[model samples]
Target: MKILIAEYAGFCFGVKRAIETAYYEIEKNSGRKIYMLGEIIHNPQVISDLSKKGVNIIEEEELDKLTEGDKLIIRSHGVSKKLYDFLAKKGIEVIDVTCPFVKKVQDIVYEHYHKGYSIIIVGDRNHPEVRGVNGWCDDTAYVVNSIEEAHKLPKLEKACAVAQTTLIGRYWEDILEVIKLKVKDLVFFNTICDATQKRQGSAEQLSKKVDVMFVIGGKHSSNTQKLKKICEKNCKNTFHIEDAKELTLEMVKDREIIGITAGASTPDYVIEEVIKKIRFLKGEKEEE
Candidate 1:
């Protein structure tokens, strides 16, 4: 089958940097125990591959129990500064792999919080990145994903708003609009990364022309979920899969135009394999 791919899909700058850093940390700590604070970049395959290389993914609780000499690697989603300091106090080695984009947000939020503005974090409420952002302000920052929350802000005499890099584009705009009206003094930093914006735009554009769309990325990846949501709005035949193995042959048997797009955390080879399987099952001639 002729598969059209999104030009912007896969390994945004931040995720690429994070993954590269993790692998390098693994190599550097050879013959020594290396633990990842969380799945490095949300991709199960990537974490599984790291595990094969002796890198262990540990929970905060388990890591809390680790001895002073143990080494822990932070994921691309930056941890709260409090956690970093705590680890140092415990004499644990820390390898910070937080994305530069995330670090920038933390810096901005820290500055605004100290300046006496109530912080508003725009993103998923439970996402690690969002939680980390909230922790910067002692969890005083308001976390909201919809316009309703923005309108209900008890009061916004002075506020600073920031969005998670992988949020729905329009939702960010909507929240900003409402908050602008209610707050007497407001500042907003569009922290949404370019990679996410491009991917979301490309996914929507492809969905309009394709008969079936497959979104490939880690199940836990926020950006991947956003891409799928964008595609679903434009196409009914949208499927979100981490790998081709998760796709069934029957679903695309009748589809003539297939579109494949992956998330920032998805590797190129995984997308290639899914395209290969789709062509094989559909009995369509593969494009060179």
Candidate 2:
């Protein structure tokens, strides 16, 4: 049996930076109360690790309980402008680790919304990133995750569209095409992160060549779910798993070529663990 991994698998630059910053903040503010706006990233293992280190997840309602001089770590998903204002008014220190790409989308939406253009978001409406982006437009943006949603939108004179960072590329394109027809003047920003595009591309290619594919990441992770969808289209035997334990020996035991890919939030150690587990199950020596 042979094992192949996608060239762009595991945590991307944004996620890696956020995780590193979270750890640094924990150490730097040892005496102060520290809270994360949300899960630092979607990976449970990483969140669990941070929790062990005294990083508690803070929800919107819980924000009021935080006192002045408290530190709130902004997760990579980011929070709305309203949340920022509230934090500032309360004199809370914010350690912002929002992915730069996501920040760009927020800026674009903020700028265009003030220019009399209707804002449209091509992404999951429920995603925290989408919610945060919508906040910039005063929650007036039309959020659509599919071509059908775009079709349902009322005709508009002018609009600006942005996508969730982890959205699938083809879905973004399809939604944009529909939005164009519904609006007289349309401006769309390709806010999908480059890392996301590369990861999806690599996963699709690897899936096509492998007998079995394993997509590793937290089950709730958006990018991980997208990777699983992309892989499933090319390889029917694809499995979406959060960790090595979720995978069983029988799944890949007889497969001649097994492929592994992970979401942007996945840790390198998690990927390595999966690889080692596979190798051990197959009675093969681990790589040095």
lDDT of 2 at 58: 88
What tens-digit string does per-residue lDDT give for candidate 1 at 166-193?
Answer: 8988999989998888788999999998
lDDT of 2 by residue, 117-207 (tens): 9999999999889999999989999999888888999999999999999999999988899899999999889999999999999999999
Distance from true location, Cα of 80 in model 1, Å: 0.6
After TM-score superposition, the amount by which residue 18's alpha carbon in candidate 2 deviates from its true location, in angstroms, is 0.7
Q: Pick the candidate with the highest lDDT.
A: 2
Q: How far is candidate 2 from the true structure (C-alpha RMSD, Å)?
A: 1.5
For model 2, the run of ten residues with the poorest summed lDDT: 279-288
In angstroms, the error of model 2 at 24 is 0.6
lDDT of each: 0.87, 0.92
Global CA lDDT of candidate 2, please? 0.92
Candidate 1 Cα lDDT to native: 0.87
